[model samples]
Target: MSGPFVYVPPVNPVNYPPSPVHYHNSPYLASFYTDPNSPFIPPLSLSGNASPYQSPNTLNSPLPTVLTPNAVPFPASSSGSAFAPENPWNRERRVSWNGSVAAPTVPNSSWLQPPMYHYRRRSDAAAFPFQQPVDWTSLSPYAPYRTELVQQSFIHPLLNAEDRRNDLILDMSCPSFAPMRNIGNNQTAPITPEELNQLAFYPQAYGAHIYCELIPDLPIDIRYRPLPGYSPIAPPLKVGDILAAIWNDMQLGISQEMWASLDENRELMISRAYTKRCKIWASRGFPSMRNAGVKKVDCLLGKVFFRGLVPTGDEANTLRMIVA
Candidate 1:
């Protein structure tokens, strides 16, 4: 409970009229004042023993405002529920303090928190939402690496390297002089290291050609198998045909000679007239010769293939096959 007042008139009443009156009338005020340490005392009664402050019907009624014994009682004319409010500052401060105490209890007042700061969490451990896991089939360090085996009967190095060393040529070829062979693996003198490497990379047609050369007595019937499920031989044998077949088996590497030979057959050749207008086009690198460039280069190479200096047919087949 708040301390009780003693009656005392303000010296400067015009300026400090709201000061507590306890100092002006302590003796009378003390008689009614609630003691700081004592249990509450009921208000004085109209009857000798009946308490006036204990009426159940008037429990919620406004309590009387106390005044000092020496001071004149002011008429009850104020509109405020709180007693002794003399200035707007005290009234406003009480209203503000009450509002602050109630703020957390009101659901509608949740706007007191900033919207952007609400529900925010640190993203230090967040992962990229769209990131895919690494592929272990492509990244496994101990995965086996396979070495390719060249087929014995194919003509081109590129073709030979694609198929394992199984060929009808070696199976049917004569064991005598001019026997069909498996290129570098033929029973002959040691092939040069360079040729051995080439043999390793040769396609079917070149492999067959190498086989034929290694064993001169090898029969032509042994060189290539008939197409699957039929007895028909692979196709009409031409040096360019063998070269083209082998060329098909390559990844992207094509020999200049084979490319030129390919031009004679494909008819997509480079012409002097076209190159003269574009020297840069003429001097471009071999791999770059593709599409329109391939056509142009083929035209130029075809002319050289048909020149009198180059022989045609099986007689010149060896030279044509090798150079290409």
Candidate 2:
């Protein structure tokens, strides 16, 4: 009642049209909505007929027919062209532009034929210009042929009939060089069974034999000579002394039979020890066994020591005898 009057504008609410209802008459939707879990349903045609279900894949569609131009047959003969139609089988003959049949330069059969090889005989003068061919017919059967040293070496007059028979038997079984038999005579006696047994047990003696017989008695050149005013830590050793020490050390703890029966590895160890001892002794101003004379003595001693047949006291004497 006490406030001043204020002017107010008229307010009117806007009228809007209602949303239209959507009617889904599509057969696909009708079928789908009928069973949500149903498989795909093709839509009906506008003609009110349910069309047959066709695969959505376009691969099954019938291919469009393509129209091609008709083929024109070739004429039997053409005067303008150089080539003319002929039977495919008749490859050797071709009709020329002038209507004359021409034969091929090369026969058709020759195309598939194998290559031919031509053999040329060398002239005798080109093969052997300086020498004349031997006439085998003119050679006499009784003429003595040049005998080879190897053949001559095999001919031993002392070979008995029994030994020859054994050799023949061995040749039949296993062909090899004839076995060496003892030449029995008053001067040279055959090897005893004991010696054979010893040799069989101590094969290392073969190396001694090789050193004594096969190796030439050439003097070995010394690489290092004894220096003047040089004092050695140990006394100088002879080859015999060095070998004796090695032999003693090899059988120090073991019996003679056990030492002989040592395995290959044990033997190798012993050999290495011997080589070490040699080097050590060489440092003491000793003449090394590398020297030929010393080496020969070493071989002889090696055979004697390994065989264990000679007395230890007589080793030096035996070595001297062998060297002499």
* Cα distance off (Å), candidate 2, residue 7: 99
Residues 1-324 of candidate 2 have per-residue lDDT tens digits of: 689976543423211111111221212111112110121122323452333343221354433323312222234535422235554235586655885676744423533433444434457558677765655434423333443553111111111121233221101000111112223221222222222222111111111111122113322111112234443232222222212222222222223564476578756655554454456446645435233112222322233222111212332222111121
Q: How many residue pairs clash in each candidate at the backbone level?
A: 49, 0
Residue 37 of model 2 has an lDDT of 10
Report the lDDT of model 2 for residue 202. Answer: 14
Residue 239's lDDT in candidate 1: 30
TM-score of 1: 0.15
Best-performing candidate as measured by TM-score: 1
Report the error of model 1 at residue 289, Å: 10
How does candidate 1 score on lDDT? 0.29
